[model samples]
Target: MTTQNRNVEIEERHVEKKTDSSMVASTFIKYTAYIIIFFGALYFLVRYVFPMF
Candidate 1:
């Protein structure tokens, strides 16, 4: 048995970037809903949950 080193060349194909409109809109909507829910919870906490201190 003999040990040998070999070199290999790789070829890459160019790919086109595509954007999905519905995906972008849904992501934006999801983030907006998260912000609204966070603020709403914070408001509720301040209004009713923290007064017992």
Candidate 2:
């Protein structure tokens, strides 16, 4: 019967797990390092480069 076939198909179904790559600790650490480097460069430019003019 169609109902029995459907039951068999449902029973054989697989479930997959999905994970977030961007929200991981390594990603957070990388972005934080980038932000720190950017701010450090900006500070250097303002403190040293701009004063020469």
**TM-score winner:** 1
Clashes of each: 0, 0
Residue 43 C-alpha lDDT in model 1: 97
Q: Model 1: per-residue lDDT, tens digit, 3-44?
A: 889888899999999999999999999999999999999999
Candidate 2 lDDT (Cα, 0 to 1): 0.87
Clashes of 1: 0
List the RMSD of every prediction in angstroms. Answer: 6.4, 5.1
lDDT of 2 by residue, 1-53 (tens): 35443443445768898778766878999999999999999999999999999
Q: Name every residue pair that clashes in candidate 1.
A: none
What is candidate 1's CA lDDT for residue 19? 100
Candidate 1 TM-score over all chains jointly: 0.67
Model 2 residue 3 distance off true place after TM-score fit, in angstroms? 13
- Tell me the whole-model lDDT of each prediction, alpha carbons only: 0.97, 0.87
